[model samples]
Target: MEWKFVRLLSIGQIRPGMKLGKRIYNEEGLTLLAEGAELTVSIIRRLERLGIDILYIRDEVTDDIVLPEMVADETRREAVKQIRTVYRSMMNDKMGRMSYPHLGYSFRKMTESILDDLGSREDVLIMLGDIHTTDHYLYTHSFNVCLYTLTLGMAAGHSREDLFTLGMGSILHDIGKTRISPKVLLKPGRLTDEEFAEMKRHTELGFALLKDEPFVPLLAAHCAFQHHERLDGSGYPRGIRDGEIHDFAKWIAITDSYDAMTTNRVYRRGMLPHEAVDILYSGSCTQYDQRKLEVFRDKVALYPVGLTVRLSTGQTGVVTSVPPKTPNRPIVRVIEDEEGASVQPYEVDLSRHLSIMVSRIAEN
Candidate 1:
């Protein structure tokens, strides 16, 4: 019988004869491993040297493993296309640039469709974990931030109309970046002081582009303007205090930072969901809204499905599911024992073990 279960394991966990269930790619758009290829120790070591973290492998023991996607692939593709259109149209010229009235209806229509689709789902955590075009990072990042903000809004019980507005603001929050010099914006290395200053102007530039448009709401424009503002008045352009910041801006701040940090750029790799949440928590109250940050924390998958983790009790397992009440604790399917011996697959509820904590994420 053919193996039906497929699990995403780190490169370190692969053994000879284990068949790849998915193709692997380098960040530069080259295929490194083909699907259905049996992994050998030498090939695995090459992947390690190349900085590959995880691989989908078909195994008899994990035949039932499944990882759920955050949104349908079709919907994401359409949204990205729409964003690219709006961006390209606006970047055509300074004076004769495409107007918002022309694009506002279509933009809202797309946002509504996205909301309609996401609203039908039961999962709260928004994971945009998919391979994307390295060249069109802005458009993809915009769509991701928009969806994430909408999910966070839903978790916070925003009304339907409110969700529509939030979605609109989020998708276009970084539109101003299109006006920035490509050299500084897409620089693979750290920015110089003046380049960094120029980069920070995206907030005001975006707001200026959208503020006068009749169809765009003032609230949406504010989201574009103040997304970088901090609770402790440390943010740029305005240096506004907590009370001075708008609600949607606060929400977008968290979403924007989270998405930016978790996406792979030319210079850095994407972080795991748990690791991203930890960074959000570290900046709570000082850099982000504390209450909103907590709401975000509870909604994300702390131990996302297919992630391998090591437990405090010296056990290692793959996270199978996240318990709603205790997101930090998940249902783990243990595959290795304390002595590092292969064991019969067994499930453990992490919440039940008061003393056991997730020590670290295991490299795939």
Candidate 2:
């Protein structure tokens, strides 16, 4: 189908590979197709041409994890609403005090279906970051992990089966945490030594829970067990060496860490997305898998909209969008002068202006 997010998504234009988004309210804005689904790359480029910065991805969005784009197409919203229902139920059955082994298989298959849909085009915005969060933090974290891992898996060219396995394992990596005590799980201060030890048991606990499922794929157990294991063998449960670690675990480790650190928690405020990228970069020689660490620099947004930032020239403003091929530095829409006085709106490409440096990226 000829893909376009025009006056609205034209019916004839909705084809198998064309990524879709629907404008929900003219004044209120847009949403993606649903949680866990990605927009095809072609759609992103077309939207870019229209001077549209936001194209909705189908996935769960959280209150804390802000989606920079507020407006989206309406057709995309309907598609995503159904997807949200499916994801909510799948996670509930798997994590809630319920037994639904059969649902696990369908849930995994659903992940693969979401991945193969690179839209009909090569480029699309897979909803990796825009997750909707509620009271269930651990479960929400698992869902986000699955969404992010699938995006990285496709980017790294993993086989179809491998991607499916990765998604399934990631979605459940934290299941063991559900078994931990609520006191330790929700503690506000730094974890005591004893509390830390108890918390660490989740890895082993997670492994035990997943190892024997009837439909569990090969290595699903290791994914839960070894996601915490590092290349340097400093990780918990068992400090297995890198060679002993499966490639699947390696991929999960990077994505898992990235997601965990960037997200907010009761114990600590989360790092900015760019700061999280720096952590992954620093951990490369030690804990993180080198290859997998790259996904952050490429995919994660450094300066999300509404975040305040300082420029090398002493000017400051809100981030607009990271210019193409220049993600490290973005074009900011200036809001104030260096002295904090109000200023007129203007755009500057930090990538093109060598004199302009990002002194620091500060989030409010």
Candidate 3:
């Protein structure tokens, strides 16, 4: 039977035979339970041991609520795996056991998989920073940048062929970092001017590596070369001015910055999606192409569904739906009062109440 609503409950409140309304993921983004899995005594104990205190459950009262997934779990996992494959192949080639042809083929296959999984979707407002493990940061960030770049390109009315090139470029744009020393890449503190200069060479290095490879276009190479270039010529490498940057490079720069800001790194905690968007907007024209950045704002979910938030009125709720016109102001299902007491659930459409702004992300 299809459940019409979903409810969030404490781990103690979950009983055996209750079906999971949403997939439960650990802090590392590993799935613990999939939707529709009927909880048993052991499963409940397992979740408790893992310190999970809250989850979405399918039940009679909350059966009317439905939470939409940002992307298919299978598709995201496959993309990450393929990205890992490509990175490893590149590493092998760097070690002089070259396989240019195989590497090129793998890049093409990964791009095609990306298209098949995400291209036909109506919207691409996904959570890009979900998979965050220190060791696999490169692979995870590459996949996210690729996804975000593809979405921005599509929004600009780019053709599929153009998106194919854009996607490939965005994924491999940071490949040159592999050549840098781990001492610099993994450093927790600020880098010295010398170390910073060395870090900046990734752009040139990436361009040189991919420039003449078979099946890789010159445009893709430029994407690696120029993604760092800013509109005012303040960026690294060539420091080229506004009109000199390639269209693909310009778009990738915006997505790269967005993903980088919203992702947790060893040095600092990640910003929320809306917070990152605000920073991007502040940098428009000087650090990014303002025209492209505008399109980016429209496509991303500033207040993504399933996020718990506190309103200015002191009510807390889970985001229910993003109104079409105002992506920032969403309809929230308020479940708690100002003092943290559980209350009767009700919907609050932020778009309707101009004074009720979202305060911050609330803990589940």
Candidate 3 wrongly placed segments (more than 4 Å):
1-67, 92-99, 188-190, 338-340, 352-355
Answer with 1 or 2, whichever has the higher TM-score. Answer: 1
For candidate 1, the C-alpha RMSD (Å) to the true structure equals 4.1
Candidates sorted on lDDT, descending:
1, 3, 2
Best by TM-score: 1
Q: What is the C-alpha lDDT of each candidate?
A: 0.78, 0.59, 0.76
Per-residue error at 30 for model 2, in Å? 18
lDDT of 2 by residue, 221-256 (tens): 678889999899999889987898988888889878
Per-residue accuracy of model 1 over 23-134 as CA lDDT, tens digit each: 6643332345766788888987876665455567876766676656566656776887778787767766667453566666777777888898789888657653554334
- Backbone clashes, candidate 3: 7
* TM-score, ranked from best to worst: 1, 3, 2
Q: Score residue 31 of candidate 1 by CA lDDT.
A: 46
User: Backbone clash tally for model 2?
Assistant: 36
The model with the greater lDDT, 1 or 3, is 1
**What is candidate 3's local distance difference test score?**
0.76
Q: What is the TM-score of each candidate against the true structure?
A: 0.86, 0.68, 0.80
Deviation in angstroms for 310 in model 3? 2.3
In model 1, state the lDDT of residue 161: 89
